[model samples]
Target: MERNTTRRWARLGAVLGTGALLVGVLAGCSGAAPGADSGSTDTDAALKEDVTLTWWTWSDTTQEQADAISKAYPNVTFDVVKLENPDAVVTKLQNAIKAGKGAPDIVPVEYQTLPQLTLGDALADLAPYGLDEYEDAFTASTWNSVNVQDQLVAMPSDSGPMVMIYNKALYEKAGITEAPTTWDEFAVASAAIHAADPEAYIANSGDAGFFTSMIWASGGQPFKTDGENITIDLQDEGTKKFSDFWGARLEAGELSGLSTWSDEWTKALTQDKLGTLLMGSWMISGMDDYGPAGRFQVAPMPTWDGEPASAENGGSGLAVTSQSENKAAAAGILKYLADGEGRALLNQNGFPSTIADLENPEWLDHPYESYGGQPANQIGAASSASVIPGWQYLPYQGYANNVFSDSVGKALGSGGDLNEALVEWQDTLVQFGNEQGFTVNK
Candidate 1:
């Protein structure tokens, strides 16, 4: 089945802003039509073919998982290429697509960057491969993130449903017995924790992605897109609620101003100077690297009104390139990784995205020695299920993130007014969107 090369190239040009000029040039140079696979609807026959696939990813695909994928599809060989980071993968993928060559057959794309890639029609649509049948397998928010403009462009790999990881020792020292259920309680605990140890704080602030996740958990629709028409409202009720609550605490020095993942931040974690971490479920795997495992405990994200609410922080999906000559083989590999035995192997090292894993009694109740033998997955599962629906990221979210440091980041670092910084961020996005030929509304 050969996909429409002309249409793919034209969409690529639209993303590159070279219009039909680049389209005509690439169409002529693309050689054989892309996705010229046998187009067999039979999955068994596709898996039997001897095909080699290049998988570009920033995360590790363990040898154990590789061996399992190999045994499942003996004829399929994978060339796993590890990149420096997610941004590197995105940059390389865009350049390869624009050049009409050198793109890998498979890539793990972050959920935030999925729309940016799909805008150029660079990934193969998986709906034809029976991927739509698994719609019920994932939560609505996780499923929606991988589907862009009604196209199932990627397979749900792993998700980052939000959770609160707190230092039990610090909470005990602050005279707090349990995790705060409401934002107001969290604020009070923050003050107590900081007062208990002048060098310690409840959490760190000032990362763009973290800020967006907080707004998302608070039920903010700050960014929404419908094709080329987008609505930007950083001043929504959710955004205001988050800004006002966190801003006051930040100004009072109840939260650390340290940037996340920085040397100082890691040091704070190692020394137990950081009391709590409001992060994604994926943070569970790395907790032991910073401090003793039994010292930390997982809890549901605190809510505005003492109700269950959550949002995704980081997650990615496996996507097949539209330019691949082995689309069927690539999709077969995706199916195995996303929904087959390979999924269980991957879940051993990360959080699960599928409902089967999230709801499994055994998986949810599995205890971790790091959290003092607590079943941390229970909290993660509840958070994933409670994620607010209708949350969306901009198609050009990469650009939005790059500009956040100058606007909102500065305010957060200085303990300035987050609400005003959000307005500035929204205005910048509006101007950039309109310049990109989008119908942007504020």
Candidate 2:
């Protein structure tokens, strides 16, 4: 299973320099003819050029968004190709890059998968497109997630700042007056809820993404990557803290081990068999679809200390493929989708990553009928701002997620020691990373 580390690093080094010319032009360091605005002129010319960009996306691009992008760049048209899911897009994009052809001009890459793609040099550096100016446009965590090493390979599109969505009715029934602000309070609330109704628990701990996010929010540095080197430490203090706290609850039957997003989980959600859900702000958009309107309410995620802390659950970035024949045009489309008018349109489906959208008075104050007319965006904004920084995902996060059920998940229902499970998970990741030619340190 050994890979060519030397070749991969060489390719990445070359990719890092791909945007130097554009970077120089954008920085006004490119010596052009007097009174000649090279950066703007080049961008205008590229936008005005007749080009049809193919986009590979798992999420649907609204007709309004398409029309807006078209109006912005009349010369550019899109052939949107919808894939089944994000994983499918990743597989196809990887294959296309290896084949040196047949890749789309644009793709939506999940934040976790960006590292692997960048290491493989499959994406173009977007610094030349003046995207570097957008550093302040996004939340710090969201912005940092899209930057691999020094290269800006993608633009932050949507983000999933963690929040706790609870059933207000269920909480009231359990005699819990307010949402828990600390993990200690959460434990008490969990006991209260389970005692009130034997069938309902405070939350579920049977999801890999949820576990990873919990560890992140607890300030765990489970994974860190630098070029071909990686660090995997699943038994960090944060990891043990989360595992010990939740593991006790699982053993005491105060928490459910129902798998998230499964039919059974969905049934529990709709039937009010679950009291709270600690997930991302994106879940708010689908609250009504999950249960009766006004039943779910948003709250900041409970913290280890009685202070603000959060982590990202899910999100994606828009990137241009290196295999594209029309890189400039493709980059323009990405900008529109991520930073321009299309951003607002895209926000209709998910929580926004940009500061402008997050802080906009209208958006922040907008109340959701599904959330009992509460201004839930305020909670989402606060959580996004409070996300504990420096969380890093492994390059092979998809595989890590897939193997979680077998390792850490084995301890969930059985109430076994999660710290031991995490050690097993760490060993598995270390071996996988070494096999992939990475200098894995556990």
Name the lDDT value of residue 74 in candidate 2: 84
lDDT of 1 by residue, 1-442 (tens): 1468888987887877875678787676764345566666555567788888888878775445666788877898888888989999999998888777888888889899988888866898899987778888777888999999999999888899999999988888999989999988898889999998999999998588899999999998899899999999999999998999889988898888888989999999888799888888999766878777699999999998888999999988889888887888888777776665777877877788989988899988888888878999999989998999988999999889999988888888887888898999999999999998999993
What local distance difference test score does each model get?
Answer: 0.86, 0.84
Clash pairs, candidate 1, are 293-370
On the 0 to 100 scale, the lDDT of residue 352 in model 2 is 97
Give the clashing pairs for model 2: none
| Cand. 1 Cα-lDDT | 0.86
* TM-scores of the models, in the order given: 0.91, 0.88
Best by TM-score: 1
Q: What local lDDT score does residue 333 receive in model 1, on the 0 to 100 scale?
A: 78
* Deviation (Å) of 80 in candidate 2: 1.0
